[model samples]
Target: MPKKVTITDIANLVGVSKATISYYLNGNTHKMSLETREKIRQTIEATGYQPNKIARSLVTKDTKTIGVVIADITNPFISSVIKGITDTCTSKGYTVTFTNSDNQEEIEQENIARLKQQNVSGIIIDTVDANSPNISQLAFDKTVMVDRQAKKLRLDTVVSNNRESTVNFLREMKKAGYQEIYFVSFPIEGISTREMRYQGFMEEVTEDSSHLLILEEPGVEKRIYDLIQKAKDKIAFFTMNGPTLLAFMKIVNKTSFRYPEDFGLGSYEDLAWMDVLNPNVSCIRQDSYQIGVLAARHLLAKLKKEKSSSSPKLLVVPSESVIRNSF
Candidate 1:
C-alpha cells in the first residue's frame, strides 16, 4: 500500500491551518471564506484525504450513523425497504448499520441494544413483535419505527395501511362475486400487522369463523382440504402476507387446483413470483421502500431537533391494488 493521506496533507496543499480544514469537515464552514473552502475541498479530492471518521466523531460527539433493526432481512419486502433506507441515508452523508432480528422479540430487543452500544446517531426499527416491551420504552428522541406498530403507539412510525387496505381488497373480492372469502395467515398471536389484516377481513367478512383459517391451528390441514372441496366454484382465498400466501400456493399446486378458474386467490403482499404464476395474482402493492425512507428521514429530523407532535405520529403509506385474474 502507498502512504495514507491525512487532513494535515490537505491542509499543507491548501496553505490553510489544520483547524480550518477541521472546521470544513465539521460543517462549520460559515466562518471560512468561500475561496478557502473551495481550495480545501479541491486539495482533499486531489490528495485523497480519508479522514478518520472515528476520531472526528469523538470530537463532534456525532457518528453521523443510523442503526437499522429489521424484522427479517430474508423477506423480499423487508429487503426492498432496506434498499430505500440505504439509498436515502447514503445520499444524506450518513452511514447505516443494519441488524436482522429473525422475527423474534428477544432478538429484536438485543439487536436494538447492540445498535445503541455502537453510538449510532439514530435508530430505525422494523420490529418483529409490535407488542414487544422493548418497543414501548425505546429512546423516543433517537428512534423511529416502520413496517410494524406497537399495540400502544409510542414511537414515530411509518407503515402501510394494513387494516383499511385489507378491508377494501376483501370488499373488492366480494364485489367480484367471491361467495366464500377465506383469510389465511400463519398466526396473529402478538403480531400487530397480522392482527390488523385479520381485523380488516373480519369487518367485511362478518362473523364467519369458518372462513378465518389460522394455518397453525390444530387439524388445519383437514380444514384446508374441506375448504378447497367446498369452494370448488366461486371461492377466493385472501392471505394476510407473503409467507402465508406461499404456503397456501404450495397446497394449491399439490392439489392441482387451477386458479381463477377452479379457485381465486389474492394476498396482502405482491411478490415477484406472483406475477409469473399462470393467472397473474391480484394483490396489494405496498410502498415498502417508502416506509424505510420515511422512517430514516424521521429519525434524522429528530436528531436535528425538529419540532414534532406531542403524541407519536403514525404516518400511513398508501397501497395500490394490482388487479389481475387471480381475484
Candidate 2:
C-alpha cells in the first residue's frame, strides 16, 4: 500500500513548521505571506493530505460538526428540510451528524443526549414535543429548534408562518363561498404547529369545538359524514398537515362525497402528490427547506458568538398559498 501523507509531510515538503500547516488548514492565514500560502496549498494538493478531524478537534475543542435530530425522516417535507440543512452546512465547511426520532419523545431526548455526548459543536432539532420538561432544561446557547416552539421560548426557533398562512387560506375558502368550514387534525395535544394553525382557523370560523374534527377520535368518519349531510350551506374542510390531510382524504374517499361538489377541501401542506390528485388540492405551502437552512444558520451564528441577542429569537419563514380547484 502507498504511504499515507500527513500534515508533517506537507510541512517538510514546503520547508514550514507543523504549526504553519495547521494554521493554513484551519483557515487562520492572516499572518502567513501570500507566497507561503500558495506553496502550502500546492503541496497539500500534490500530496492529497487530509487533516485528522479527531486530532484537530481534540486540540481546538471544535468538531466543526453539527448534529441534527429529525422528528420523522420518512416525511417528504422533512426530507426537503434535511436537504437544505446539509447543503447549507456543506457550503460553510461544516458536516452534519443526524438521528431520526420517529416522532417519539423519549427517542428525541435520547438523540439530543447522544449528540451532546459526541461533543458536536451545535445541534438542530425538529422536536417531537417542544414543550417537554426535558427540552425546557436544555442549554439554548448552542441549540436551535426547527418546526416547533417551546412554550417558554428559551431557544432559538425557526418555523413557518403557521398562524398567518392558515388564516389567509381560510379567508380564501370563505371568499369561495364555503359557509361552514371544519378544521381537521390528529390532535392539538400542545403541539405548537397544530395549535397555531387551529388558532388561525378559529379566527374566521365559529369557535365551537364541534367544528373541530379529531382524526384519532372514535366515529370521526361518521361525524364528518353527518356534518356534510346536515350542513345548511356549502361546507369545506381544512386539514392541519400532510399526514392529517391524507387521513382525512382516506376517510372522505370511502364515502360517496367528492370535492368541490359534495364538499370543498383545502389543506396546510402543499405536497407534490397533492398536485397530481384529481382537481389538485389548494393549500398553504410552507418553505420547509428554508426553515432548515435558517435553523442551521442560526445555530452557526450562536456557535460563532455573532448573535447578540441573549433572549430567545423566533424566526418565522413566510409560507405561500397555492390556490387550486379543490376549494
Candidate 3:
C-alpha cells in the first residue's frame, strides 16, 4: 500500500530546507525569492499536494474559513443566496460554516458570537435585526452583509435596490390604472429589508398613508377579509416577500376575488411558484444568487486585505419588474 505524501517529502524532493516550504505554505512566499516561490508552486501542483488547512491555521492563528448566517433558511429566496455563497467560497478554497437564525434577532446575535468563537476568517450575514450594535461593530472588520442591510453601517453590504426599484415599479402599476394600491407586509419592527421595501412603496404613494397594511399572523384571515371589503375596483396590492405573498394568496383564495380586472398583485420575490399561478404573478425578479456571490467576494476581499474602504459602502444590485397578467 502506498503512503500519503507529506510536506517533508516535498522539501526533500525539491532539495530545500523544510522551513522554506513551511514559509511558503504559511503565505510567506515574499520571504523567499520569486524563483523559489514559483518552483515550490510548480512542484506542489505536480505532486497534487494539498495543504493541511487545520495545521496551517494553528500556525497562522487564523482559519481560512468563512461563517455565514441567514435569517430564514426555509425561505426559497434565501436558500439560493446561500448556494451562491458556498459555490464561490469553495472555488476560492475557503471553508464555509453557516447558521440559520429563523427570523429571531437574539438567535442572530448568538450565531454571530458562535462564528467569532470558531475563529473564522470572515462573516456574511442576512440578518433578522440589522439595528443591533453588535452588527455594526462586526461591520468595521471581518463581516459583510447580504440581502437585508443595516440602516446605519460601517461595513460592506450587497443588496437588491429595494427602495428605488419598488418605487419605480409601483409607479408603473399606478400608470397602468391601479386606483387603490396597498403595501402589504408582514411587520415593520425595524427590520431593514421590510423597512426599505416599505419605504419604496411610500415614495411612489404620495396620497393617503392609510394604504399601508400590516399582515398579523393571528386573525390574518379575518384581517384579509376586512381588507378585501375595503378594496375598490382596480385595487392593486404589493407584498414585501415571497412568504408574505403566499399568505396573501391564501386569503385571496378564501373568496371569489379575481386579479387585474378586480385586483392587481405584485410581490418582491419572484419565486418559482409564481410562474404556476393562473394569471402569471407580476413581481420583482432579484438576482438573489448574484447578491450572495457579490457579498462573499467582498468578504474575501477584506480577509485577503485587498480592500481599501474604511467607511461602509452599500453595493446595490439591480432588479427587474417581471410584468405579467397579474398586474
Candidate 4:
C-alpha cells in the first residue's frame, strides 16, 4: 500500500511552514497571502492529505461533529427532520452521530450517555419525555431540544406552532357545522407537543373530558363506535398526530362509518398517505424538516459562540392548514 500523506509532506511540497498549513486547515487564511494559500491548497490536493480529526480535536477541543438522539426513528415526520439535519450538517462541513430512543425514557438516557462518552461537540435530542430528570442534567449551552420543551429547564427548543395551528383547524371544522369535536390522542402524559395540540383543540371546542378519546384506554374502539352511534348533532374527530390518526382510522375503518357523511375528520399531522385516501383527510401540516434545520443551526450558533442570548429561547416554526374533503 502507498504511504498516507501528512500535513508535513504537503508543507514541504508547497515550500511553506507547517504553521501556514495549519492556519489554512483551520480556515485562518487571512494570516497568509492569496498566492501562498493557493500553493498550499494545490499541494494538499495533489498529495491527498487527510487531517487526523482526533489529534486536531485534542488540540482545539472541538470535534466538529454533532450528536443526535431521536425519540422515534420510525416516524416519517422525524425521518424528514433527520434528512434536513444531515443535509445542513454536510453543507457546513460537520459530521453527525445519530441514536434512536424508540420512545423509551430509559433508552433515551442511555443514548444520551453514550453520545456524551463519544465526546461529541454538541447534541440535538428529540426527547421521549421532556420532564425526564436526565434532560435537566444536560449541558444547557451545548444541547438543543427538538419537538419537545421543558419550561423549567429553560433549554433552547424548536417546535411547531401546535396550539395556534390546532385552534385554526378546529375553528374551520366548527365553521363547517361540526356541533361537537372530539380530540383523539394516544396519551398526553406531560408531552409538550401533545399537550399543546390538546390545549389548542380545547380552546376551539368547549367540551368536557368525555370528548377526549385516549387510544390506549381499554374498550376505546367500542367507546368510539358508541359515540358515533349516539350522536344527535353533526360531530367530528380531530387527531393529535400521524400515528394517533392512523390508530383512530383503524378503529373507525372496522365500522361502516364514513367521513363528512357520518362524521367529519381532521388531524394535526399531514402525512402523504392521508392525501391518497378516497376523500383526502384535511389536516394541519407542520414544517418538521425546517424545525430540524433550525435546531441544528441554533446548536451550531451556540457551539461557535455566535449566539448572544443568555436565556434559552423557544423558537416556533409555523404550520399550514391543508384543507381537504374530509372536513
Q: How close is candidate 2 to the true structure, as a TM-score?
A: 0.94
TM-score of each: 0.91, 0.94, 0.92, 0.94
lDDT of 3 by residue, 123-177 (tens): 9988776676767547466888887777676567898998888988898899888
Which pairs of residues collide in model 3?
Answer: none
TM-score of 3: 0.92
RMSD of each: 2.2, 1.7, 2.2, 1.8
Worst 10 residues of 4 by lDDT: 146-155
Task: Please write out the lDDT profile of model 4 over residues 69-168, one tens digit for every residue.
Answer: 9999998889878987888887887899999999898899999999889999999999988878988768988999989988575789999999999999
Tens-place lDDT digits, model 1, residues 1-327: 999988888888889888988999988998789899899888888887888999999999889999998888898889888988998899888999989999888888888889878999988988887667788657888888888888788888898999899988988898898888888998786877888888888898866877788887898777777777766458888988888888887777767567787777899998898889878889989999888888877788888778466688898998877888886
What is the lDDT of every predicted structure here? 0.85, 0.90, 0.84, 0.89
Top lDDT hit: 2
lDDT of 1 at 93: 85
Ranking by TM-score: 2, 4, 3, 1
Off by over 4 Å in 1: 231-233, 307-310
Ranking by lDDT: 2, 4, 1, 3
